[model samples]
Every structure is written in structure tokens, then in C-alpha cells.
Target: MHLAHYLGLLHRSQANLASAFREVAAAHADEPDIEHLCLRQAAICDTHAERLHPFAERYAEEAPREPDRLHSTLFSGTRTGGIALLRDLQDLYLMASECDICWTVIGQAAYGARDRDLLATVRDGEGETAAQLTWLRSRMKQAAPQALVVAD
Candidate 1:
């Protein structure tokens, strides 16, 4: 079934999000708030990974689970300043927005499959993700002035 494919892709995306979050937490030393948020998001992603396992197995249905690939969102070069951290946060926002789309797709699939568990989880996660998007946008607003200032 296509559930296997959807779950697989979602699982991989969550893992990458978690990795990026942890990396940002470590790399962006000056932005304590962003670091904390990233760590929290990483934990959420880990939870999502766990939540997805049974779904993947349940709907696999001889579909030979399409190989899950790591979609890397690596930011190259040395990290420095609030600007760098802001940019990282912005990138995360973009990823999260895309994830919003994935979640919507999952919801649609859930309706077709008539899977209550999948529907519930997708709906709950979508709300939580919306909160995350809001928080990230607020963080960006708070960081912008400091990030935009140049040394005199």
C-alpha cells in the first residue's frame, strides 16, 4: 500500500529534521533560545519516528518498503553571529512549512485508507507543527534586529 511509502518518507524527513535541529543547537552557540527550541524539536521528531514504526509495518503489505534515503539539508561553512543562527532558524521554518504539506498529504491518505490511527496522529501533529511554526516565526522576529546590525 502507499501508506508504506508515505510513512517511510515521513519517517526519513522527521529523522533529518531532528538531526538538523541537534546540529543547529550545537553549532549556534550564541542563540540559547534557538538552541533550546532545536533540541525540543529534535525530541519531537524522535517521538514521531517511534510513532511511525508500527504504521510502516502495518501497511507495508508486500510493497518492499521503498528504501528510505537521508535528505540532507546541510549548511556549509563556519557558523558565526546571530545572523548565522537566524538563517538556520529560517531554514528550519522552510523545512517545517514543507512538512506541513507532507502532513496534509498524510491526512488525505488517511481518509482514503480509513485508518483512524493515522488520521488522529496526523491531525494532532499538524496542530503541534502549527504551534512550532508560530514559535519559529516569533523567534525570527525577535532575532532580526540583532541579526541585521553590522559592526561599526
Candidate 2:
């Protein structure tokens, strides 16, 4: 059914998030914590996508053609300086939030379909996604003071 469409959406979104993480990590390499955490989160996104692949393929046979414009770009690229770091983290927060919601929806679908494997994957991924959001939020809060208030 429409589950395939969402599976595809989540898959692509995970890939996009991973790439954006790597890009931001590299762009802000000066910030060691940001770089390390971004890299770790990128790996987590990759694992989530890998887990979803078999399910996406299995349901595709029953799924209608995917809808157009199902995907949106959240992070174009990273920018420079303190404020830019905050903005980039905000972009990541938005992207991770998308993945978080998708995981919830898909988890519900898995429960309906009686798919234990998918449910477990969703549960695990959702927790990690939540952690990513938390870290992003905290980092943004830390950056805001310097980015918005303190002089260069």
C-alpha cells in the first residue's frame, strides 16, 4: 500500500541526512566535538537505511508508484563562522526530526503489518534519532550565545 511510499521516503531521507552530516562535519572540522558527533550520527543514519532496505523492496510489489516531490533538501551545505555553525546545526535538527517522525509512522505500520523485524529496527533507529536531535539542540543552545551575542 502507501507504506512503500513512506519506506522509500524514509530511506532517501536517511541517506540525505548521512550525507549532510558528513558535509557539515568536514566544513566545521575546526570544531572537534561537532566533527566527531556528526560523523557518528552519519554512521547511525547509514545503519538505519540499511535496515529499511529489505522491507522497502518487499513492500514495493504492493505499493503504487511513488508520489512526486516526496523529498526535500534540508541541508544544502555548511557555512562559515559561529552563527553559520548554529544555522547548520539547526538544519541538521530539522532533518533528524523528519527521520524521527518517519520512524514513528513506520513503526506503527510495522505493528499493523505484524512485522517484528521492522518494528525492532524502527524502535532502535527512533531512539538514536531522538538522541541526535537532543545533541543538536544542546549544541545550538551552546553556540547561540557566541553566535548571536558576543563580538567576533
Candidate 3:
């Protein structure tokens, strides 16, 4: 497949993932901690989609489409109990990792084509996403319940 096709896929996947997170966030909105984290994560995904939209328009043969399978799988995976919360956080981490992979591939392709503008834009977006992931990690750490101390 062409680079544009791959980038478009990534963009759609990011958007779909964000939408799934938003759904989960809405479900858990009463829980302030989880809700805040989910909202932040949803914002990051929205930002990623926005950043990739221009590239998709310029490079792709058509507009990006939603990644239905990924979205469905993510939603199904998070449809449980406390397990869902943990799964949601894990999914966010996985999505962030995928974003890094996509950025690396796109950046390499842009460098090979001598496309400085694309490279710069993708790199900046990647950096922001990475930072957001770091923030999410910190939030996850905070959200994790402390282990009970056992009596000897």
C-alpha cells in the first residue's frame, strides 16, 4: 500500500480509539479520577486526528475513514467491571505506542522523500503525543489503588 494509505489508516485508527475512550469516559463520568483521565486521553486522540487530517487531505486519494474493527474491539475489551478501567488504561498505553510507531514510519518516509514540511509537522505531533502519553502514565500511576498492608 502507499504511504498515504498507511497514514490515513493510522489517522482513522487514532480517531476511533479516541472515540472509544470517550465512550468509556462517559460511562464512568461519575468517577472523577477515571473520568478526568479518560477525558484527557480523548483530547489527545482528537489532537492526533486533527494533526493528521491535513496530511491525509494532501496525500491520500480520499478522505480518511473510521477504523471500525479497532474501535469495536477496544469497546468490547473495556465492557467489564474494575477490569474495564485497567483495560482502558492499558488500551491508552497501547494506542500511544502505536502512535509512536506510526510517527517513526511516517517520519522515515518523509525524510526519504525530502519532504521537510511533512517531517516537521509529523515530528511535532509525535512529540506532543509522546508527552501526553507520559502525562497519562503519571495519571495512571496516581489512579492505581494502593496495596493493603498485611498484618504479620
Best by TM-score: 2
State the C-alpha lDDT per candidate: 0.73, 0.83, 0.70
Ranked by lDDT, the better of candidates 1 and 2 is 2
Q: Candidate 3: where is the Cα deviation over 4 Å?
A: 61-67, 77-80, 146-152
For model 2, which pairs clash?
none
Task: State the TM-score for model 2.
Answer: 0.90
Misplaced by over 4 Å in model 2 are: 61-73
The better-scoring model by TM-score among 1 and 2 is 2
lDDT tens digits, residue span 11-120, model 1 = 66776777777878888756557678789988987887677777778877222222223234344544676588778878778767766777889889999989999898
Report residue 110 deviation for candidate 3 (angstroms): 1.2
Q: How good is model 3 by TM-score?
A: 0.77
- Model 3 Cα lDDT, one tens digit per residue, 1-152: 37786687678767876776687687767667767777777787788788778778778634344466656665664455554555566666766676677788888888887878789878886887788678668756655553122221
How well does candidate 2 score on lDDT at residue 128?
Answer: 90
How many angstroms is residue 71 displaced in model 3 relative to the true structure, after the best TM-score fit?
A: 2.3
Q: Name the candidate that leads on lDDT.
A: 2
